[model samples]
Target chain A: MNKIPALSPTVLLAVALLIYPLIFSGAFYLDVGVTFLLAAISASAWNIVGGYAGQVSVGHAMFFGLGAYAPLLCYKLYGWTPMAGIPFGIAASVALAILIGIPTFRLTGHYFSMATIAVAELIRIYFGTWDLVGAAIGLQGPATARGWWDLTFRSELPYYYIFLTVLAVLLSFTYLMERHRFGYYLRAIKVGERAARSLGVPVQQTKIRALVLSAMFTSVAGSLYSVKTGFIDPESGFGILVSVQMVIIAALGGAGRLYGPLIGALILIPLQTATNTWFGGGGTGLTFIVYGGIIVLIARYEPGGIYDLWEQISPRRWRRKHAS
Target chain B: MLLLQVIVGGLLLGAIYALFSSGLTLIWGMMNFINFAHGEFVMLGMYVSLLVVMYLGGGPAAFGFGAAFALFVLGVVVYLSLIRYVLRGPMLAQILSTFGLALLLRYTAFWIFSANFVSLPQTSLSGTINVGGILMPIPQLVAGVIAILLTIGLHLMLTCTTIGSQLLAVSEDRGAAMLMGIKPDRMQALAWGLSAGAAGIAGALMAIAYPWSPSVGETFGLTAFVVVALGGFGSVPGALFAGLIVGLIQALSAFWFGPIYKDIVVYALFVALLWLRPQGLMGKA
Candidate 1:
């Protein structure tokens, strides 16, 4: 028997992702794929600060909502192509991250998380009432493609490619970050703040930097979401559930690992989509039950998440040398 | 005259906030654990009250006690099952575990109850009381008084009771408490029970006056966190003072700036407060 060459998992995943649209030719599956990539993008972005820096923000949806609003706002108000608003979304998210991070980073543990929630909720409430963003009525993107720049594709295939490319870039960036000194600084901060400061890690600055980068990418993910969905609302874009999903997804895959969120999105999005499809609106309860169950199980059985769980169960020789 | 009415209304609401928040603060003080599902416990309390009224044909007192008893048992069960396991886990695990529990509880409620908003059927606690030209709804007045009494009662229990000391001892130092012959597990379980019972009573009280759905927990939960933080974690008396203040602010803001903006005002103040006094009003430096 000829032994099949041992291609690395990363390469295999990449190959599979690149050809996913071709294999899953149906619109439904392609849409699911796109949704998965979008979720992965946001979760991975969240991982930058939440996973690596160990600051568990429960209000990242504020940035995602801001990003979602930008593109839709541009289309609605200025009649400009939604893509033109991506930079503005990124800018707003970066600025808000700086504004929120400076003060919130002072808090530790649950205090920090609660502060984020308060701030994000405040923002969401403001946006809901603010007429410029269309108030509670929300904003809509292009109904139909005004031009090629409008990105209103009839098929989900284009979005799959677009989102896949974004995910690939984000993952690569995270991979590079893992090897960089900044990544080390983040890990140091995560281990313990006072200790990291004692070791001259510039703890506050490092955290703020991670948050800014994280917010920028999270904003991009939101913008992409609005582009695909062609609408943005306070509830859909800025809800607490949005923030929770990101944290849960990142946690589920083994936070701090490069592929953790990707793995999380891979499992969770399909499951959520399938449940919603099969059971309709009533399935929402089941979805939430599943999410809650997963969170409790992971926290109880393996806080390191599925990745660490696998590492523990896998054969010694098969385990990666530096699994963590 | 209108201002006085608003202030009175605010205080009444604040009393309820304090009642539930004391439970949250108790948990934090005892275990340094934030129960993300504290709101769910309150939600369950409301449901328990509703069921008591619906099936048991109970009055306010009966349902209130029923809710508290149900939630107290639930808190103990939760402590024994999920919380005990994650207590030693990473902060991430600790946070997410309760969060998951919150989701599970919330959605399970949704599945069982459906998503419709429900109110208690006409009970004996109906009508309003005119107090010095300010008409206070009977339910609100009664709920407020009961909530205040219960909160103070809880505070006194902690300071005066043997069980209270044991709970506090475990919280202050688990190893030392164990050396002193106190079973840390039992005390912690009791703390959870007491904490959840308070939340349950608050929920039951609120159910008498306010129409609610399963999702009401999120609002109450966030409000409890704000109250706990404002009052300084682990302080029941602080929760009382802070709850009253928050309730007043919310009422005044809503009256002045429309109801929609009230939450914005509360949260803005909360964030600002966190920045200025991260230790909170009564928290130890």
Candidate 2:
């Protein structure tokens, strides 16, 4: 509401996270926090392209996997600190972004996006079956690093703050992007590329720029997840299903909004956890049935997603307006 | 011996690819749309036939054809209710809606049927045909023959039948078709029904060769996409030839490199082909 002031929402949220642990000191709160951080980062990173540029990438897990691997691979093989791997991960993701985006953007729409998904799977499978990362055995995140430079922590609190910081940085970056010149160009292109071209908007460059920036931020977060989790594998990383989940999160949240991804993570991640618990370990069928049903219902009815629905009912939007 | 093995394996695999890709190619040719849920139809066909065999206690031969026929009817129902409306809409709508439908079918199977991989109830088509020191699969031969027949039948339908002409007219130009007394919407629906039915037959054939599970649709769907792209969007013969080439590439690649790399190699080829020639092998300039 305008009465509450729009900018205060984030400040209040930070206060809540910082204080919530103080009030509720249990394993449950920690579980929610950990899960929330994961979803928040993934969804927010996805928004850079899906929400802002509307590229509909179904293969974000590629960057995520690269991010996860860079740090771990460096630590294990080259004996480099995890901090140094951040730039390496970003570089790898950027290279992949260009590799995928260059040829893919030549045409248009979701074909390129869908094709990228298969590539992600290919990489995952190659890694999974290869003896390089111990194959399917999965390399466990090193537990006893000698120094803080490795980015490994003995407690969950360090990870909590790290992801919290990542979430903040991503949100701010996306917020600033939504209000900038490139942002306006992206919005214009989303309307109609040809029309935007007619209006002198550099269509090709703008799309590439959106994707590159999105990939950089997403990679940073992916690295964090790998370190936090302490292990990585094919099925857990660069699979099409993970990409689908990220997309669903972006869609469920308002696509183009600054804070929508966080809102999305709050709703769905909890639902997933509750479902898993009820079934006691990946319930056979009913969960997916409900999940698929929700996707169908949303696709049919609420293409604008839940956040857009919320905005429609807001008091500000509901105020009396001038007649047409 | 190598030549015989490659030839036999490629042909059999080609038949399965042709059957599935025919439906996809037809939809793309007329509609210029790709259904992300396409693989699900094939998966559904497999399951349906599986259930029929389980209930009726007959071999794949006795009830397989009838089950496939029943699935064809369901395909028509799907087209009527869902896929028809999206043909003329934005590309995103068709892709997303079909994806949703696919998810619906996949999860519905998961909910009802266990996910622990089940084959067709009865394997009626058993036995091998050996020729020149190379053993050929009988069921695969049946699948190939049927695939070729369906392709020919589809070709005949498109060229020789009035209904086919109506469908072609709509695809060429919607406004022009309307002027010529054709209902473009209905034609689009019919195209979807026919395509789904073709995929159903492919699925039944697939069950004879291997097995069916709920989520097995994605890999086959990806293969069909490659074939459709390679063969030229609207060309039936192109799809057939392309499917065969893909099967050979896959089989050879599986032997040359590893099975895992085969997918990557083909997709990389698809991307390169797209880059060098977007219209595809048989498409008109």
Candidate 3:
């Protein structure tokens, strides 16, 4: 809250993130770290539209699925490195955003959300049955690194850094956007579409642009996931759970805030891994229960998320306000 | 003959879709709130019916009513405990609360039921009946008939009854209704009960013909959403017609293009429908 040291926390946080893998060099902690970064990437991407624009899309998984597939497909068909598929994934997701956004943006609130779900489900079902992409069996990356470009590695450390780099880029971009006119337009639309339009905000075009940007990042995150796991199953790629996770993580962190999702990922991914370790095979059910509980509590008490609670409770915030 | 059989089956399935979807549509109409956990209510209904049959040695009549009654109670409890609180929160909260409730309900069922698919033991509802030359399974036939009857009954009650009028009044304008002798809370609670009770019965009926696990709710929930949207969000009759169309499309497409593509066909049409008529087939713009 102090003006003299406002930038220190961010610098410290960056330093911590940089040193995290080194401090917890164990495979388990690194795996969780990598997962956290992946979740952070997707959740942050989802915030562009869902958080800022208040679109509440429950089907961003389709873009993630497309992203996951493009790289693997490139490897499967052309014997090229999976990383080479990143642009294709981004392109496809952008195109899909245009296709979906034009029609779906006409509907508002629940209607728009449901329409996105329908489109995503359609894509998932198609992917599940399409033999060219290995149908229900799904596609896999190289078992081991075929070459330097494969992006495959034995340790989780590489993925941690890779995902962290992506998250850093995404967060930096979002930070800039938050201070820009485009971000203002998105927030304006979120407050009231009609009012924003009345004030001369190009509501439809702005929403589509936000969605395109969100989809591009989401696709990249998906590409990273497939690269990390060396697998891309239909369920993992395009499942509703995948989409819901992005929403939940963003909501948990504090949607619309630049660092909300990163914080959410920091807490949630570790909790999830811990639960899985403790509960073993039945851990999934418990994890969902926990996730559900968090969502309910957040909705009931602090919809602004943990950061919002921190703002209210922090002594620094109080002192700063009183001083002003 | 085969096509007729398929059509009949589709209609029967459609009737069930209408049965559950009407409950969802009712909540949407009354409160402008979408209960993402509606399908979880149905899943619980299936389990309720299963429990009644397996433990109490109940027949179809008992289990059907038992499921409905249980879900009605649950509906009221959920509204009072969770939905009521979140209703005052932000739009995101409103959306995510029910979704969270959904995950909670679904996984709890998984924990309790062990994720194994279960079905009712053959009771009096089991058997096949011949209508003309085509054979119709009695469970589905009865389920369909009851679903249609109940949906129609619900429609009439809303149109003709005092309670229905009060409910509609609350939905129209809570402030105005509150000024009148009506307690908006009670009416809304009643609406949830009725909506969930309908879903409960739909689940019980579907259980007769299908093997299901806790995850069954996900599919049924999505299907109910499609039915509700396609029929027009708040229109009961629209739900009926739309439900039939979806069922028929799903059935025919599954039969023609294989089971995997059926959902694709349905969702494609649904998205296209939304694009063409965002208001839905029976909804007011």
Candidate 4:
């Protein structure tokens, strides 16, 4: 196994991303990078509860939609800036997370997942019919002048940097989560909720906190998504596909690991772009076929995901040496 | 009179839901594993019926039977090839494997059938029967009647037959069943076959009344989960009762409030019910 220094790889990656646009000067590549970063951030946020706490929520699109729509709605109704609306978006998403978590967190495993999907779908349907959010037509971000405050950018460069920053912040948060007492509590719950409760861990409280944190981060990503796309529709924002994609990305990379979602996003975003560029015109299902195939193979062969694959291939001596 | 018609319509729809959900509940009971791809099995059944009609010029009975047989074989193949292997893995693996299977089946249908919504050609089962002030569509009435009969038939076969006993024995304890000379693997595979076959029949019945695309499975899948959970995860009769209730609620709500709010009502009630009785309506606590 190669004994590469950890910080060096991260530093090199940062430098590569910093210079990527300047060297390539391609709009498509920049867009892909931005998407990758955004996905990483979303999946990382998902990881706080889903990966660490072992709560497989498939209704995260609810948060994403709230994040995306809250800002756009505030801007349209109250003339507030996108940046100013973000906190409100986060607050709304957290509040929703609590509401949902209080009931759903009582269920375990697949039941919990099913409840999340149902709740998300109910909300999506409600949004679709509500006339205030333009009904099924969906709400659009204000066509404000291009500026940092509005978060509307003429070039993809600024969006890329902003997404990169968000990813960095989320990654740091995940790193802290892994080291903190909260992280231990989450891991304990994941191992066995009954056992954790018997051990005096506040299982429900810990899960609720993790869910709130996860929702807060996911909502931020949603806000950024609307700013970048300039649209907020129930279908795109709260769609089951959106929820499924986040789970797939996090699970594909390695749910519990700090860097798992990043790795997953790195691989999947390119695959998505390439598939769209190639077979997109021919049919819409081919890309999903590939995704489905990858998911099955990964689940059957390596449920621990790409991170586990890395650990397996790495020399035992080195892995054991770095084990924390 | 309109309210009576709505109630009748809801009951009919609920019967179909029960028919499909019975298969899912069966598999869950047999193995304690939820088949996420069960909806795809129904979707495939619809496609199979469509193909039989289009290519072989089969009538409803022929096409329905064809779909059931084809899906039965597919289910057995899936169990032996995928479920058998994944069952040995982690709980997450089992969940995701079926989820993956659902995606694979759905997208494969998308690839072959494209995304356009398709309906079966109007067959001999068209037209409606008016009894008093209520008018019922023939195809839906037939489908609903058959669904109830089949659900009852499945329940009987499970409760009354020797094969049913053996199947139950396997599910109750694989090792003990094996010691008793029952092949748990074969019985489990049979369970899958029956489950998929039921889904196929339900799909064929549904195709008679609805236009659907490849992606329809997602909706049906969610509905099935709700029904299964509400009925009690592994209880067949529970699924039947819950399916009917869900169907009735959907119809009444859609009539009273509009189609959009129907799902919200069903799901809201479902979530609330699960909160109160996590074991489900029929399942033991």
Per-candidate DockQ values are 0.74, 0.48, 0.71, 0.59
Candidate number that wins on TM-score, 1 or 2: 1
Output candidate 3 Cα RMSD: 1.8
Backbone clashes counted, model 1:
0
User: Across residues A1-324, which tens digit of lDDT does each residue of candidate 2 receive?
Assistant: 443455566779989877665676576777678778877888788777777776767778888888877777777777777667778989999998887777667676656665666667667877788787757765566777768877787667767777888888888888788778888988887767789889999888788777888788778877887787777777677866567667677777767677777877788888877887889765635555665666555555565578878767767744333111
- Binned by DockQ into CAPRI classes (incorrect, acceptable, medium, high), candidate 2 is acceptable
lDDT of 1 by residue, A31-51 (tens): 888889999999999999889
Fill in the DockQ of model 3.
Answer: 0.71
Stretches of candidate 1 above 4 Å error?
A: A1-7, A320-324
Q: Lowest summed-lDDT stretch of 10 residues in model 3 chain A? A: A1-10
True contacts kept of each: 0.86, 0.32, 0.75, 0.55
User: Chain B alone: TM-score in each candidate?
Assistant: 0.98, 0.92, 0.97, 0.97
TM-score of 3: 0.97
Residue B29 in candidate 2, Cα distance off native in Å: 2.4
B62 in model 2: Cα distance from truth in Å?
A: 5.3
Output the lDDT of residue A265, model 2. 79
Q: Please provide, for model 4 over A1-324, each residue's C-alpha lDDT reduced to its tens digit, 9 standing for 90 to 100.
A: 334565666788789878887886799888888888889989999988888998878789999988988888887788777677788889999988887788767766677677777788888999999988877888877675556688788789999888888988898888888889999999999888899999999988999999999999999999999888888889988987788788889889998888889889989998888888887676346877877887788768888899999899999987987674
Off by over 4 Å in 3: A1-4, A316-324
Model 1 chain B: lowest-lDDT 10 consecutive positions: B271-280
Tens-digit lDDT string for candidate 4 (B1-285) = 999999999999899899999999999888878788888888999999999999999689999999999999999998988889888665557767887888889999999998899999998899999989799999989999999999999999999999999999998999999999999999999999999999999999998887889988877887888899889988889999999999999999999999889888987876787668777888888
Docking class of 1: medium
For all candidates, the clash counts are 0, 1, 0, 0
